[model samples]
Target: MKGLRIIVTVKQVPDTADVKIDPKTNSLMREGIPSILNPEDKNAVEAALCLKQQHGGTIIAITMGPPQAEEVLGEVLAMGADQGVLLTDRAFAGSDTLITAFTLSRAIMKLGKYDLILCGRQAIDGDTAQVGPQLAGFLELPQVTYAEHISIEKGNAVVRRGLEDSTEWVRVKLPTLVTVTAAVNAPRYPMLYNVEAACDGSRIIIWGAQELKVPETMLGLNASPTGVKKIFEPERKKKGQIITGDPKDMTGILIDKLQELNML
Candidate 1:
């Protein structure tokens, strides 16, 4: 068996727990809020690590953001990724999910051959959960999302994906994309000793829009179709009803409530 080439995408997001919203602007106040690697992305990295260990491969950790985003690349490298790539440029600024995926597709193309691409189900800051599928779409590859387990067998990738009330297994060929959930694995803390080396500028590949070969006109805010009209918390007007009783009684109560709301 040959070693597979894997690319794992990660993100640096504001620690949502400490996120603050400006009442006046009704927008996020991100300044001064400490940023960390997206939590679910840790599981994605762990999945890549485990696959690399089992199949003997190189894992490339890549991210798109400001220079400060390299911290996450360092963490993944310290955790065992073979290489790190930072995709940063003013041309990539203010990109929504669509253009973000487009830029990443171009970057991934430059990264060369890969057996698999892994990503977190969603980023904490923007939970659109669209990038993975969109990336796959741009690359014209098969994709599976919400993956809780993944394995390679006979050159095929097997994935177990969890859904709201059920789970399903999917089998896809290599050169596929899969978005992983936190249930996949517990991420190992980065080796403290390697953190310094991992973050060294010489070790990380830095590429801007020019290196991507994509024109400036096709990148950034102007190219993005989705715009944020607002970012405000929705007011909770209706309280949830609590129905507790035997199965039949509970079912009856639920039906009554649904009927009252004309939702049944």
Candidate 2:
């Protein structure tokens, strides 16, 4: 088989542990928070790089977010991706998974040739796990999700998927998309030289809505079918009553309390 042309979709997200919700906007408060490449996405990149190493191919890493999101592309490049593509625009803000998938599909189409597309099973911030399947639908390509292992031979890709109670192995024709779980493989750290080179502007490509030619109606929050109405931390309420008595009395009291709470 010829060398593979691989594409990996990635994202930049605020560190999940430090993420905060905005009470005023009912959205994630990303401002002033440190951002990093989505953890699972790093696995996807590692998978792509591994395949390229074995098959003599090129890997392109792509992501969509604000201008600052370019940092993710830089990281991917440092990790051995041959190219980095960023899709960013004011209009892409507030995009739900559907719109996000559609926009990514458009960018992939613009790339013209590719033998495989890889994605992380989910983003930590949203944990929706919807974008990969949605992107495959938009691109009209077959997809393998939650893949833990992938092997390619004779124009076909074989994947092992980790499921709830069992594992599944699937083989599909080339030019398909696969969403990978973190179990697939560990990602590599960038070499010192590659890290330096990744910072060079020439290594990254940037595209906005105008370049993508996406319809304005399909680009942002307006295109999203879901909306967050509000966000707030659930109030913590404590209720307790100590049955300070003999064991039998305490048992009886507990039973009564359970009944009062409709447990019986």
Per lDDT, the best of the predicted structures is 2
State which candidate has the highest TM-score: 1
Taking the tens digit of each residue's C-alpha lDDT, what string does model 2 give over 160-193? 9999999999999998999999999989997778
Please report the TM-score between candidate 1 and the true structure.
0.89
Q: Give the least accurate 10-residue stretch of model 2, judged by summed lDDT.
A: 227-236
lDDT of 1 by residue, 93-177 (tens): 9888999999999999998899999999999888889999999999999999999999999888999999999999999999899
- Residue-pair clashes per prediction, in order, are 0, 0
Q: Relative to the true structure, how large is the alpha-carbon lDDT of every model?
A: 0.91, 0.92
lDDT of 2: 0.92
Question: Which clashing pairs does model 1 show?
Answer: none
TM-score of each: 0.89, 0.87
List residue ranges in candidate 1 displaced over 4 A: 22-27, 237-264
lDDT of 2 at 38: 94
